[model samples]
Target: MKTTAAPGSPAGLLVLWTLTRTALLLCVLKVIVFPGPDVTSDVSVIYRGWYDVLSAGTFPQDDVTWQYPPAAALAILSPGLLPFLGYATAFFVLALVADLVTLALLLYAGRGPGRARRGAWVWVAGVPLLGPTVYARYDVMVTAVAVAALLAGVRHPRVMGALVGFGALLKVWPALLLVGVRRRGAWVSAVVTGAGVAVLFAVLMPGAFAFLTFQKDRGTEVESLGALVFHVARHHGWEGEVLLNYGSVEFLGPYVNWVSTGALFLTGAALVWLVVWRALARRLEPHTVADAAFVGVLLFTTTSRVISPQYMVWLVGLAAVCLCFRDSRMGAPVVLVLGACLVTVLEFPVWFAHVVASDALGVSLLVVRNGLLVAAAVLGGRRLWHATVPGWRGVAGVPGPAPAAETPVAP
Candidate 1:
């Protein structure tokens, strides 16, 4: 036996987590300034403003930037939990706590029979790659809830459903976590819980569902896959102007709406593919839910009209949960998502000015980052379909032996 600690030993992993998270906190706290734009301004300025409005007992109905679900107000108001600290400082502290909770959940899940600690390692490494932006946004807190929901999916599906419902209200993407769930209880619980939350918010808060109409006139965000069209067009006399619209930098004018519409069509096609996959799937393993969720989010994220840097946090969390199971075949997609995360940080806050200019550096970063996402979506979706659907290995135009009947795992 060696005297030195192994790389993934519990103590070593904790040490690494502590070091990286400490650096993240320092950057968010302004003790060490992160290069590029001030990522914390959202917390210090926008979130604080929202906090005041929420405390007044109504949503930010008039603000076009308030494009999130009603439950998102809770996240904005959460800094009130630590009144001794300033608003931004409290938000950062709570973000750190959420990050810690996510890590603990991954570590616990990784200790199960046939599970490995690679998922915990993934969480430890992936977050910091996006820099202080992780702490500046409420997305990390939402991710903690999503991580818990996925890890609890097999044994405690009702719990998973309830959490996913609450998480969806928080941001809306968490609803995709239910794509692979086969149990009736999970679906029933999700519907009841989501309805209850929506009704409660609607009754008590004015304009609770106003977020629905906020994106009607939204254009293609400069960071999205479709925005690459305009980035290239700008060089060849595409006259669209980049402007701060509806809380994100987007290309507006010319054929921007057409590109945005194309993105929506791609999203609809992804939904159709998922429906087909679900219908044909004949097997379900312990890791299958996580794998399907990872693939589902990948497809939607890559095809969306906006692929904000913080969106990587959601993918990282789902990817971590997938890796907790030794049987999960999402390894290649996980690596690609990690690569995208690294590129995301470079494109935003580091050399973000270059990206906005549609110059060589910014355009190159978008190409690499978005390219990685597209590749991951395709590969991960294919792997998920092959793993769950029987007869995937049959030769083209030649029939193969029937698949043996197998009992599906109880959800």
Candidate 2:
């Protein structure tokens, strides 16, 4: 197997990054911009609805598929403002912009005194490796906000909160970052600002709360880790059925709801563990908050009843941010995450039919992918825990934290 290029070797890192960037750029050119009906449908179809909402100044209350918060309306309408750009082109441009912004953040942050470029390496490599799904969905926008929030979490806690709050409006997952905030006032600021923005939109937008009811009726998504159990059971005469619902592949038969509930319960349990871990950590490194946030998101993503292919983008994004911290010691786990991203691409557009059929290839893909996610989560969680433990001894001869692991820079 090919080993990770050494972090100390700038030449090796450059070569790898260049190759990843080129490959990703080509993937975008061929897959996203030049996609067939299936791909365009994902992008243009959603764009049309958002454009209509913007032009008419109305929420998609009547549309069953519009399940996001009212703040999402702003995101949907954003690309429409691009001058002379068609909806699809504008959407693609917006996705590219988000990707570029994330890369810029990682690159700039890596240049700081104590930071490392490994996180940038992760972003450059992981995003493209995730395939065209990066542009097919709006997840990249939320990821950009997430990157900004994490980079600012220590130095400017309130700013971090505001960014995360705005991100949560676009997608609920970003709010999870609030749990990683260090200061009591800072955490409160993030919560209040995020909640305040959400409440403001709820009051002004018609369909702001519509998503809650809509989600209540959702079946377990076929791609979720929970669905893996059903996929295996399908071979042994399980009666569950799979179908495309609410824009995702989901299980719609007996016990599907039960599986979803179980997943939610597990997620809740994970959150509780995280809160306790943060409270009790003996030595909390500056990077601990970002690393903890990464672990929390990994738990949320892997355990949730929905694991869209694009979900990998969120996973890799946070993982990349965490790896930027020199002391994160996430090298092994991040490599696994990158490998998982590649497998996800194969499991998705390449062989999604097999996945739907629960065939050997599909099941195998899911197995490898989900297993990696589980491993990444476990390893990442463990590394974060050890890194934060107070008075922890360093490896052998090393006594203090590594130079790259110094306190985070103030913004």
Candidate 3:
């Protein structure tokens, strides 16, 4: 869809250049300028290591670090196709492409009017605000799939199904979007499509389900909201060790695994809340699909035991898409989410040493960042619930229609 806003218009051009400049700058810094063991090196190790195995026409059957779904092999193996490019450079380029695609989708979605049009601005500004981490993780590509699937869910059921299925192969989170589908036909299509692709990958790859086995034993990452319990406890004479385990900074000691288990239970409760909310709600507006999806993701991400800095990109992308709808009530919560993203970057690549030390600065950053997330989660849940659930305001004696317009149709 073409935007009514001209390319040279102040809003459009500003957003375009902002994204372009940030991406170009990151490329220079990460690829050519910076020289250190950074996110790129981490990616290089994973993709480049796996690329060799793939080129030999075999799955990484023995590599425990290859802890993603088999479909991720497509991403891991892709750089081998570009024989001329270095693995690190190729990985950055690929991530950059996904970043741009996500920005384009957000821009296109924001072409409507009023606050709905601000969606593009949110996305354009949000990704770069995530700082260098934007191009560092494969999560950005999965976010692109999420953007496309949400955009397609309104008109193309099968397309939405295929996109969600494909995204699920890369990361488990994209499958959460399926709960927001309105029509039963669309729901079934999404499930069947996802299952079919997963089964195909399992048959073709030796370690397709290996990640599942590895994921259950993961420790509580230092950045997760759930990990705050251990972080606070460490100050009060908890005798735990902080170390990089299973590819993330985590707390490993007595009661650490128990906290991780508690986080999982919280996640399960969040899922049940979503299912019940959907069942009780009388309406499913086209825009509310994105809203509900954002809420779902917010619940999962916030409550999980291993929230990485890059995880903010997931919320930022979905929040922008949610804001694309004229009737979307996520305005306030989206602002909180964006603020949290900026703080996440600050806490990570900027003051990560402090985070590692678990000193005053690190704890403060965690407090602010995790506090914002909690606020966003609470506010986002309230907004979506009030919008979808009928007669909510009536309980407060503020009844009679509640001053809202009919839900806007998807573009």
Candidate 4:
């Protein structure tokens, strides 16, 4: 008997993806002016500038804003593949292609036995929720590689490792994707691939590693969890100024360094917790990898000195991967991440001026967005602990298996 497909069936998802993506492309291309600042300027101005420098066979050696790793040059130069189209237009088109590739991967994963289509819906809905910023930044392309890596990890650990190595060079966050992976081959492949790429770039390009030095002086961005201190302090005459530092708007005055240090400390603490979880986890499953990766990224992101709106792309992509598994216990955290994504757009390009000014509306939005992220991180960590660690009740208070009873044997 033929059963009618649900509204979120693969075909329906493809249609919705097409419609929403068209809207995003329109906004990015400037045919439809999105509310707030022109987000596409990054691609047209900053990225194009870097592309010019990279094309000259060198990194942007003198530009402080050239903060990305060497592999980012590929994304900047990718627009050259469609030289007939202008750089900005070609970039947007390529971003859409990356988006499509991610969707295709999710759809294919969802059709496997025991997998669900909820992940596809999450990707389709979550990307548009962040507005045109998804396509305006190169984060979406990096996210596509991440989504592919997670989907492949269950069956192709080597492939997952190689992609993770490449994606990490594109942007550093994808390295977190390996937090939950237990395969030795994946680790070996990641080390080999990463070292190989690092060596190749070092040999071919001068200043390939200059981005490391550029990060040492970064201040807390206006949208970070620590930035709330400054936002509230502004009303209390705390005598600090928000300024564009590095490539982001950051709090640049009194005690800003202290807050940035605190954020780094929190990040260190998050690492300790993950290391503990790895040592204690006994119930490793296929889905546990995605769940742990989601939790790990959430912890680091929530504790980071800069919580840019585009960072939400990484969370959304990881959250979607978690939902692909029927046994995954990240449903609540995924919901919180989606809510955060919605609020991120509001705090960013929509009311970014208010955020920069540290006004009440901006403060409220930051509280909500950062609060959701914090809640998700805590809840996700607890859920992952219960589901994997022995002697704790799993999700929904279901008791985990007790240790096997020792049987007496005749000696």
Candidate 5:
């Protein structure tokens, strides 16, 4: 983590930072070349494919099972113009941009190497899972907006809302933060900001409002854990299918159907309860809020079937926010950083290999990758929860709001 050492910052720090960044960029270039570019490790490739369709001036029209929300197809229309260059190349460029944006957002939001190492860990963990769901998906685009929104929230609420709203347009999950904002009138700010985005989307895309509104019509995405249903049913030799659906594992599942509905609702309800409890516990002083929000995003990813690799970028970026706050007890942020790296490696590279192979080994890899992330989210959330409140005071100076029974640490 880069530090603003008072009086005398490390003399070689800037040089080291520049060299490190240059090396990483070169490494990215090498990775792209060797793997023929991981189009599946990012949403850019998928966006590129859509761009091919969009340049023809036809909205996804639900013709080819346009998996993503409509806003994404609209946003990625321009990149299709580079017909001479392959989709993989454009995808790489976008992934690089997303990586750079994540890094820049970390720094701009006041994160240091501690968080950066966590990001590196996530990158490594995710490298294996980098195929189809990540490279060929648009998770990063919305993820970037979510990150930028969180970063902006500290200094600028309006800015935060726009980023959050844009992100929400790409995927509904980013809207979760609307409930996370606790400050008086902050809700109003978020509403205005989100509404402004809705209006702009309408002006620009002309029927985007309709796209945003009738979300019910979108079909269940088999890529989510719903795929597990198909897999399990196939194993039973029930080849004939009925119109069974399980929308995104988070929101629509419980309300739409019978089998997974109660389960999904319970899961989402539990998450909501946790969020509300944590927030009302009033542990969310600015720094703690950052930490908790990072945890929230992590929890969301793990519990939901949509474990897109680029979603890790959001966790890494928000972790950067928490790390910048002098929140950890170690005085050395490297502990969290290293854990994040380990988990990311377990998630990405390992899973990507599994997804590519499509064999037993690959399935196992996906299972373990998901397991590690769930563990990370649980442990990380516990840490953040306790960190938010010590024995006597919640944070350094903040008063406690949660009952003492909930505390795990002494002052």
Candidate 6:
């Protein structure tokens, strides 16, 4: 039997054409007409400071050292030569290009699905009222490498492992790629590449390795699990004390000390167990890597002590990859992430000015932003029901095309 789905009507096609033209025009206007003031902060400040350090022949920590791994500074300082865009604009455009690369990698990986899946990246670029595309951050470069690494994982597992190991040096999140990858050869490759990158890094800055070794001494954080406990304690007015419970160290907020390590360990254990479940069940599919990575990133953002806006760049780039998923159900997470980003842009750019001026309006936007992310999680989890292990997994003793945990999810 043959089924013929009707082609999109002329009217529908016309609407899409009109929207694309409007989006592109708006993008140009955004770039030319509204040359925004440099009001953004975080890695913007970090990157500029790094440039000064480089020009002065001093490593970052010697002056105003930020917490990122050393290789991240190389990425941050890359746009220095483009005087016209300023370090900021050049960095911004490069970030957008990186996102395009992520989109391409996603499309290439999912090409087996069909054209509609591949063409979805085009529609994603047209999603109107999206957040500002340019923000200064290393997330873009790392994300570009990370997405490329994911594609390479399927085609060139050894290279993928190497890329991820290097990317992990830039930002710790890339380490998660090791979970979904099952090959023993890839693991050895990752260890070898990571060691080589580490050796080069050592030569670059004689003391960097020592700094990294003591990296854990930096500080827990106000935004993290044990810190949150301290925050609630302070509000109620209690004596705060620090304790190491079963390997996890914690501190109370504001004071930065006095937390139960035991509680932290328990909480961490639960989260780690959940991650293992997601991995063991093959819940995070290769085609859904973009979606899963966003969830992983948000897990870091929402749970970690810092909520830097530039971090949004990482998730947004991955969102582009998820949108490239041919499955509509798989693509829903992209829509949620898109909404969250627009709110992120609105929240800042003026530092709570719009929010505090009209509290309800600001709160509404925040609610919408988090709500959409929550929805994306639901859609992504549902993918567990439909995902089928590839033939390659058969060699690894994983079943082929097994029935999903439930029915096919509507992406």
User: Which 10 residues in a row give candidate 2 its minimum summed lDDT?
Assistant: 31-40
- Candidate 6 has an lDDT of 0.52
Query: What C-alpha lDDT, on a 0 to 100 scale, does residue 46 get in candidate 4?
Result: 91
TM value for model 1? 0.96
TM-score of each: 0.96, 0.88, 0.90, 0.95, 0.66, 0.67
Off by over 4 Å in 5: 1-46, 52-58, 67-70, 78-91, 111-136, 203-263, 328-360, 387-411
lDDT of each: 0.91, 0.77, 0.77, 0.88, 0.49, 0.52
lDDT tens per residue, model 1, 189-258: 8888888999999999898998898989999999999999999999999877999999999999999889
Superposed by TM-score, candidate 2 places the C-alpha of residue 298 at a distance from the truth, in angstroms, of 0.4
Clashes of 6: 10
TM-score of 6: 0.67
lDDT of candidate 3 over 158-266, digit per residue (tens) = 7887888788878889888877676666667767877888898777656677777666667889998877887789889999989888778888999988899899999
lDDT of 2 by residue, 38-115 (tens): 454666776676668756766777666777766777778877679698777677778777887888788777877668
Best by lDDT: 1
User: Once superposed on the true structure, which residue ranges of model 2 sit more than 4 Å away at CA?
Assistant: 1-37, 390-411
RMSD of each: 2.5, 4.6, 3.7, 3.9, 7.3, 8.3
Number of backbone-clashing residue pairs for each candidate, in the order shown: 0, 1, 0, 0, 38, 10
Error of 2 at 257 (Å): 1.9
Q: What lDDT score goes with residue 124 in model 1?
A: 95
lDDT of 4 by residue, 1-411 (tens): 753444656777878898899999999988898888889889999999988989988998889888988888899999999999999999999999999998888888887677998998999999999999998899999999999989888888999999889888999888998888878888888778878888889899898988888988888999999999999999998987888889889998999889999999999999999999988877777788899889999999999999988999999999998899887889999999999999999987999999998988999999999999999999999998987776665446634444443212100
Tens-digit lDDT string for candidate 6 (1-411): 632322343234335434544443344334533233343343456567667775654455543245566567567777875777766657766655665565456555555653244333433342333334343445767877877776676557788788878888788778766654556666778788877887786677644443354334434432233344454454466565444321123343344532434434544653584376455544344444444455555454544444344566666655555555554345555666666666666654433343323345544554555566556655554442234332223343333344434323111
